[model samples]
Target: MKDIRIGIIGFGTVGSGLAKTLYEQKDRLRQKTGANLTLARVADISITSLPKEYSDVVLSNDANDIFNDPEIDIVVELIGGMEPARTFMLTAIAKGKHVVTANKALLSIHGKEIFDAAVKNNVEVGYEASVGGGIPIIKALKEGLVANRINYIKGIMNGTANYILSQMTDRGLPFAEVLKKAQELGFAEADPTYDVEGIDTAHKLAILMTIAYGLDVRLDDINVEGISSIEPIDIEYARKFGYRIKLLAISRNHGDNIEARVHPTMVPENHMLASINGAFNGILINGDTVGDVLLYGAGAGMMPTGSAVAADVVDISRNILAGAINRVPALSYLPEHIGKPRITPMTDLVCPFYFRVTALDKPGVLSIITGIFGKHGISIRSMIQPGQDAGEPVHIVFRTHRAAEAAVKNAIKEIDALEICSAPTVKIRILNPE
Candidate 1:
């Protein structure tokens, strides 16, 4: 069998997991692929906690050792950042080595540059572990769903946000409380801005949209909204109206345009995505011929992410053994064939909305609110106003039919200026049926 030497750059949670997988499953992988995959070297700043089984493998503090090594056929990058990871991967490709990475942020921002380098060097870049963890959604889009024209993709791409929302819904806890608990449970980072604020989901969404739509979509094009604004009252109102609230990353192909956004969405109760609770991730993809398909699994962790990285290694190894370089384009479309579609602005988005307003329980308050909606051409589908004492502010929730986002924003501004209103009105967009 032809030997395919592998070098790993980081020995953190995922890198350690990859090393362990390669050490334990070497015989099985060789038997299945007829390739002798070897874990030749690992480079980390510190290797004190390196697993006992990998002690025999070469270790170095400088990543350039792996990048410059002549025997290494593939370089797996588990370092999660933009600076050194990007530089290392570029150097690896420049050295004519296949690259496998789990760095979503790096890929989302610098993918085009890195892919161009790989093409110039006549090498393949595998990033299946960059998005969806262990879901295999990338491979599915590249190979399995290649025959169909994808129409849309919606996913709960951030597990930390999902876990926080799941706890808030199940326990009726507020966002802060649930986030604190999530941090204690190691599901959320100490600095939770990326996960809670929807930036992490935007990174993953950019990758998926690029592959599915054959476009060069960037993170800047995605309209992002966080789950920090979601409240217990909104969750209660959503449940009362046969819907569940989830942080959804949505993208749709609109002929000459594309719609890509990440925000808190109200999904119908019976939908499969609504049932995907806790720290799990679910993706619903709509293709012209395949109709709809759902991919669900653990979106993060050591082994789950490691499995994806290992799969990428095996795939690249197969290509090496067959002497086929650049078998599949990085984005599943030929570089010249990829089109640049205009991104639809949030102001022009047309969708139903759920609104919660705190206002004084006066006779003319409802009339004024309804009049404002009518002025904006936003028709109400349904509303709930629980009986309250005449002098105190009460919660009034309304569900509106499809309307332009600009119109809704105008109405909200006008409504908030009213003297009878107590707090800023909250709005959550509702997802249309698949």
Candidate 2:
């Protein structure tokens, strides 16, 4: 019946947002949850000085202050990395403090260890804000859609990369130019490798895959391909063929093995996810009985992400007050009920392909390319010559039918080795979700 004392670690963007939201909506939260949420301690490296509201509440440069506090009920970790964050969360769990975090990278990589620690300590760990920002996709997977077997999940997870690629397609701007604009808008980090290189999306997908399918998939196991290699010309050609380029994170349970990959995919223009533009994130989940489900919302930001974190705080408060057992398992499924599946390798994945090749603008070149594809048993669904620049290289686009990824790679190697070809090939998976 007393207030739940909260401590926030790493008061950066999301942490500060949580603190401000707690103060701004205190009255409403108290009325709804029947328990007051109060921030008793805050930790961050950037603070030359702490906020005035927390003058009485302990403030520290070291995050251990939260773990050591006897009154703190929940320790929220917003620090976005493997180090210190992992150690801090573990320390909190060891101290019998409920752990909540928005750190996807840390969770994706070391989730098993963290979850085991929580279970050992008989505490709860909430990570609703980890995957889809404010979308609450994690809760949906854990609670709302708990009955259905998840067949597949596809999502646009990285806002910066999505924004850049979407802008490039719409405005016909070069990738570099669009990325520069995104950087200026504070949508991208100084080192955008994590976002642009598919690592960020891969991390989120790993967490989703584990929860949805109850599989333990490491980050290295996921086949990751970023959108940095996408040329503006590819986008134009894709549009000509009624497709849009998007960096998608896809996970599927394909009976034999699990397919988890993050890459720049050629999604059909009419598909619902294709219309998801700008910085918004959308997830399409295929359930056995529920059919297709779509969840879209603000993927990132101060208030949006903070709202998710706050919701978890309220849920924890209610459960603790009612003496209800933690109904939701840490990884969606109960620990003993977790399924073990092998991560299908890239070469084993079967999907349609969209490839671009630079070849000499001359007769018989197209025939030779098609000949090699046939030899490798790769059937071409369609082909296009997107015009030749004045004295520049000729661009050819090919839409190939579904085939083993190994065969596609072999075909591309054979085509690249042809005397008529000018450069390495560009291949993007074509996802035709009807």
Best by TM-score: 1
> lDDT of all predictions, in order shown?
0.92, 0.88
Give the residue spans of candidate 1 off by over 4 A.
Answer: none
lDDT of 1 at 169: 94
Candidate 2 C-alpha lDDT tens digits along 1-434? 58899999888889888988899898998898888889998888878666787576667888877788899999999988998889999999999999999989998888989998998988899999998889989988888888988999999998888999999999999988888889999999888999999999999999988888887767877888898888889999899889999999998888778988999998998899999999999999999989999999989999889999988888888887777636678787888877666888888877888889898888778888888888988899999986775445798889988878999989888888887778899998899544
- State every prediction's TM-score relative to the real structure: 0.98, 0.97
Candidate 2 CA-lDDT value: 0.88
Write down the RMSD of candidate 1 (Cα, Å): 1.0
Candidate 1 lDDT tens digits, 1-434: 68899999998888988887888899999998998889999999976456677766788999999988899999999888898899999999999899999998888888889988998999989998888888899999998899989999999999999999999999999999999999999999999999999999999999999989888888888999999999998999999999999999999888889999999999999998999999999999999999999999999998889889999999999888887777887789988877776999899899999999999999889999999999999999999999999979998999988989999999999999999999999999999765
Alpha carbon deviation, residue 331, candidate 2 (Å): 1.2
How much is 91 displaced in model 1, in angstroms? 0.7
